[model samples]
Target chain A: MKYNYLNGKLTIYLEEELDMNSCKIIRGVIDGYIMKFQPYELVLDLSDVKFMDSSGIGLILGRYNLIRLLDSKMKVINASKNIKRMIELSNINLECVQYE
Target chain B: MNENYIKIESKSRSENIASIRVGITSFLSTINIHFDELMDIKTALSEAVSNAIDHGYGQEDTESIVTVEAWIRDEEKIIIKVIDYGKGIEDIALATTPAYTSKPENEHAGMGFTIMESFMDEVIIDSKINEGTIITLTKTIKKRKSNSKKVE
Candidate 1:
């Protein structure tokens, strides 16, 4: 997975299954970017993500914490139905962001 | 039908996570469960295994084994167990509490037990301070009735 900083927003493109296997890398990358670039907002694009487990949830929540610390916003886009349901069950708004 | 088991042992490396996810999903799908139910099972199982690898094993290079067992009972209940022999949780009660994690530096949300409790019908954890841990979860499937009176 790779993340890019553009237009004052940090966009992360996820690949492969977002389970424990990829969390370490994903977390490291996102945190590094957040600290270095300090973007005004964070956007996680999950168009290519095929699977996500509870660890994935933890990863997102951790990012949410960081974004809050920076007084910024975070949004997810193109999440799969399963991922969408998981997010919704966690009481996050799905319509605020686009779903592909 | 009967007891079906899959075991994978590796160092505390994160690479083994994919295998664990695949193993649990395959076992659950073979029994003809709903997708939502399967996702719940998978999520809970992944949390358990990740805890074993990340917390119990400390994400070290030492050998750690994560064993998963699944079985169907009378075609009604599905049971799954995840076992690991590593640095057993010192405080089972506190460990399972939400936002309580031994390793917070790894960005641990400490919601593993919370997710497990929400996903599974029943969750039991057995652990010893220096011994190991075993987490068992069971869920009963609701049968769909196809013989309901037809609407005229």
Candidate 2:
């Protein structure tokens, strides 16, 4: 995972499978950045993610809540077809997610 | 009646999820299964394994073992069972509910069983208070036309 903070926007690049283990690691890293930068806009880039399950959804939702707590907005970009379907199956209102 | 089976036993650690996914998917790839179907199975399997490691062991007892068994029968049916000998679930019905996470503070959305059911054709859950929990996931693959007689 890689992240960049520019102006008030923070973009994170996630790679590989977002399973339980990777989510744990990624969550901590993202949370740290959120606390430090506290950006006005947070973006999650899933272009490099090869596999994702419900755990991935949980990760995104958790981050979304965290971003909201800081009065910031979050957006998910470049999610693959399977990842998008998984998100849809959850039936949760993640209006910020944009599929690729 | 093409058949293949594999059983894996590993510690209930988070890191073992990747290897388990690869092992099960590689075994299924012996035959002709669509990529989407393969991904669906993989996602369901990952959820089961995550439940075993996270909820079953309560994220503290990594020494406990989680066993994953997979079998492909008749070249079109696949069955996977994830077993964990840890603190078993008390209420199966409530646990399977969408977005009902026992650990809300820990960011657990509690969609493990829900995702498994959505991705697989059948999902069976059996748990005892102190014994263990077994999650059986079954899916029927529409065998595509391929020269992979290896399944036979």
Candidate 3:
């Protein structure tokens, strides 16, 4: 997971399969940054993510909660058709995270 | 038509996960699984394996083996079983429910079973507390096969 900060927004770029291991590392890294920088907006760039299991859903849900606690907004960008379907089936609110 | 089977028993540690997907892909690819279907199976299959490690074994020991088996049934469908001999679920019905995780502190979304059911044609789970758990996943793959290989 690579992250870039621009204009008070943090954009996280995931380029690999987001599984349990990756999720753990990302949580640590992102949480550390959240504690330090406290960005107002977070953009999850899943355009490069080829595969994600249920754990990936957990990552998003967990992050959503964290960001909401900080009064920040979180958006998912460029999720593949596959990831989008999984999120829909989970019954999570479609409007909760934007997929563009 | 072609048929084959693969059985691998490896440690439940996170480090040994790559082979599960690699082996499944190699096997399903031979039978011509569609790209979309293949991607679905890979995600579902990993979720099962991850469940076996997280729930079944409780991540207590790194040596316990999680057994994964796949059978290509006459080139028509693929059957996969992920088994672990560790602590099992007391109530499978509740466990299968969406958003129910035994390990919420770990951020387990509890969508493992849900994802498996969505991607596969069928999913059957059997568990015995303190004994083990077995998750069976089935999916059909035929789009890449030639007309000559069609059966029935």
Which docking category, incorrect, acceptable, medium or high, applies to candidate 2? medium
Candidate 3 is graded, for docking, as medium
- Candidate 3 structure quality by residue, lDDT tens digits, B1-23: 66699998899986567678888
Q: Which stretches of candidate 1 lie over 4 Å from their true place?
A: A2-5, A35-37, A84-100, B1-11, B143-152
Query: Who wins the DockQ comparison?
Result: 3
Fnat of model 3, as a fraction:
0.72
Per-model TM-score, in order, reads 0.81, 0.94, 0.93
The lDDT values for all models are 0.77, 0.91, 0.85
Model 1: how far is B56 from its true place, Å? 1.8
Error of 3 at B68 (Å): 0.4
Model 3 scores a C-alpha lDDT of: 0.85
Error of 3 at A33 (Å): 1.4
Comparing 2 and 3 by TM-score, which wins?
2
Error of 3 at B102 (Å): 1.1
lDDT of 3 at B106: 91
Q: Model 2: what is its DockQ?
A: 0.76
Best-fitting candidate, scored by TM-score = 2
Between candidates 2 and 3, which one is better according to lDDT?
2
Winner of 1 and 3 under DockQ: 3
